[model samples]
Target: MAGRIVVGVDGSEPSLKALTWAAGQAALTGDALQTVIGWEYPASWAALMPGVPPEFDPERLAKQILDEAIDQALTPAQAAAVTRTVVGGNAPQALLDAAEGATLLVVGDRGRSGFTAAVLGSVSLHVTQHAPCPVVVVRGRTGA
Candidate 1:
């Protein structure tokens, strides 16, 4: 492959849309696709709250979400052409890090954060503002 296309995927509808778009671009440009899922411990956990431990494994959950998204957004051939990357850190920073040496960075307008419609999500905005390579934020189509 000539270059790598880095795509941030978090299992959201818009993210899947971005993934689909990125996959097509990767194929057209003869670039390898790297699907990245960045996660961090719950904010509340930082407080060392006296509560029961989390029942789910965040690492496993992240991998499942990424794999399911790949399955849903790409065909078997396309999926085989992709490489999954899992990182433990803030989403925006993780994406920026993954974009290093990449030909392009792609992400959704909003992730699972459930931000309001008034503005683009913070991660997308940050990547657009500071990513080393060109960044594409895929938002929902007006009438699609």
Candidate 2:
């Protein structure tokens, strides 16, 4: 059976690189490409804000980020072949769920987090340790 490759993407530079790498791997292996992005309210949302805006849509924003990342990272035809998934919740769990049946799970060494010096971001570290499939944490400069 043909395989499916799942990749976690945020609007980070490392994530963009990871997406591009995943796309190339998928193309080489003829695997279906699945790109997943997850979003949720900030932990301090209720504490920091007086009221939640009705117009605030985390899922929509997440989808927009994912879409833009795909567009920026891949060609038009390559982007069209991508299967986009917007998940509601934490990125690590979302990626783990999406990679449940995948042949491979790919992620950037670091995401949009502030920890640039660390070799792996929290999401990448978590997924690499827990993913069901073989995990590849794409290494690169973790700036931005």
Candidate 3:
């Protein structure tokens, strides 16, 4: 069994599927599962409206989104074996950072993309190319 299995979640259907797959793998291998949600504040807005009040704490928002996504993705029984992490950055970099020393890093085939034809988004491709450990891109029924 591996020591740890890490999965990236972004509250998308494919990401949820990836989380589910990672959870099953963790249970099968009796390894700890780390579910990570990566988020970055929009730089363009901050730059455009420098004087506007900050609407939210980026770290807190990240955690809240991650927690909600995890709750929605995992059942109570399956959630017990999982640990949650919220990172401040884009998906690929955050996943790579969290994958250090991890046995495996799991991610969705695609995420929050409006482009219908874009199968695997840039983040997944980047992570697959650069993650330190083996990376698994979970493809759902959409075949992305």
Candidate 4:
């Protein structure tokens, strides 16, 4: 059976870079490529405001982000061949779940809004340590 390659995208520059790199790898390997993105409500939303959820739908936002990332990162044919998934809850766990039965899992070193000083973002670190398959953490400084 042909293998699958799962890549995590979070709408960050590094994520876009990872997506592009993963797409090229998928094309070369003839493996199915799937992009997974995770989203969750801030803890404060549950703790401070119990009943009312934010009017902005995080799920929709996640989907939009995935779509935009795909557009920005991949060629038309590559984007058309890719599958997009938006998962709810923690990013690392969501990526790990998606990587099940896949040949490879790829992620960016850091995501959007993370601490700038961190060498590796928590999600990437966790997935690299615990992913079901081999993991690739794409890391580099983006040119201005």
For model 1, the stretches where C-alpha displacement exceeds 4 angstroms are: 46-55, 141-144
| Worst 10 contiguous positions by lDDT, candidate 1 | 46-55
* TM-score (all chains, Cα) for each model: 0.90, 0.93, 0.86, 0.91
Off by over 4 Å in 2: 50-52, 142-144
- Winner by TM-score: 2
Backbone atom clashes (below 3 Å) for every candidate: 0, 0, 0, 0
Compose the digit string of candidate 1's lDDT tens values, residues 1-144.
499999999999889999999999988999999999988887787476556466756778899999999999999999988999989898899999999999999999888875766368888999999999999989844352
Candidate 2 per-residue lDDT over residues 1-144, each given as its tens digit: 779999999989889999999999999999999999988888898888868797988898899999999999999999999999999999999999999989999999888873877778999999988999999888767348
Full candidate order by lDDT, most accurate first: 2, 4, 1, 3
lDDT of 3: 0.83
Q: Model 3: runs farther than 4 Å from truth?
A: 47-55
- Looking at model 3, the pairs that clash are none
Error of 3 at 134 (Å): 1.3
TM-score-superior candidate, 2 or 3 = 2
lDDT of 1 at 8: 96
**lDDT (Cα atoms) of all candidates against the true structure:** 0.90, 0.91, 0.83, 0.90
